[model samples]
Target: MNIASDIKPDRRERALAALAEKPDGVVEAIAGKAEVTPAEILEILPQGAAVIAGKDRFIDIWSEMTAWGTVLFIVHTDDIVLEAEGSLPAGSEGHGWFNIHGDSPIGGHIRKDNCASVTFVDRAFHGRRSCSVWFMNDKGSAMFKVFVRRDENRELIGDQLQKFEALRDRYAAS
Candidate 1:
């Protein structure tokens, strides 16, 4: 299910629509059921539910996200889903690779060549309005996702939400 090759376009769209209706729908689960990648699900999201930003513009978006304070960085595999909650470190780029390291445990050598696109998904999860920034690989599978984290009371962080919306609006408008 890493690729949507086996799924019909209409069936993929229907899966996305069904996922949208669930408050705590799991994108990976939906993608699995639809025989598609989570990134593919994001790609087919209805208008206003998501925004696409080309990989060429990712540097600018990455810069903005690095300053977004603490967030939830997720990296998943079939067996495990690792989540680190902290701020995105200031990354250094050299030799076509971006290296990130800081107080957060989400440091890695990001191969820019594998980045295919970026998607901003403004959707509800766990009964709350949430947003995720997904980095897709060349195969259109998500390499990782950076999501807005909530406060101690389990409430959404207004400032972060605003920033997410601003980023979405700014990029979508351009």
Candidate 2:
């Protein structure tokens, strides 16, 4: 069965229209209305955003993220959103998982099997065009988010934005 049909057309249209009116509120709100996850909404984001199937390229993406100088690494659960700011730790695969170990605060053995996709989210935050790499799980839940840090004027760091654009351009699967 096409389960998506469970949501009526009018409801979906209203949700999408609401999203167009306020992109920032779209994911969670629409997902709730549609009975889907935020990651599901992320996949159908407008043209400017890129959703990349990243299971095969997890390591490559991880490696690139490590070089971003400093970034905000975030994880969340039902209760709280935990954030760590620093370079991503160098990681290696062992025992069927990606082992992250370094002085960096963002260190843990990421379960390789849980990673399902990555999304390059484009939006504005704090008056600056926000850019982030979101790693998601099999159920389309956000596993973590890595954000490009901004400068004193709340502007995206030039080199980091360049790298982010390059990575998204090079890896976004058609």
Local accuracy of candidate 1 as per-residue lDDT tens digits, 1-174: 123455677877767665666626777877777666677676555576668788886678888998889999998778889999889888888888988888887788888768888888888676777788988887767788899888888877889988999998987887
Clashing pairs in 1: none
Off by over 4 Å in 2: 1-15
Candidate 2 clashing pairs?
A: none
RMSD of each: 3.6, 3.5
lDDT of 1: 0.78
TM-score, prediction 2: 0.84
**TM-score for every candidate vs. truth?**
0.86, 0.84
lDDT top scorer: 1
Give the distance in Å from residue 137's predicted Cα in candidate 2 to where it truly belongs. Answer: 0.8
Q: List model 2 lDDT by residue over 65-156, tens digit each.
A: 88899998878655778888899987899998899989888888888879887778877643457888888887867788898888988788
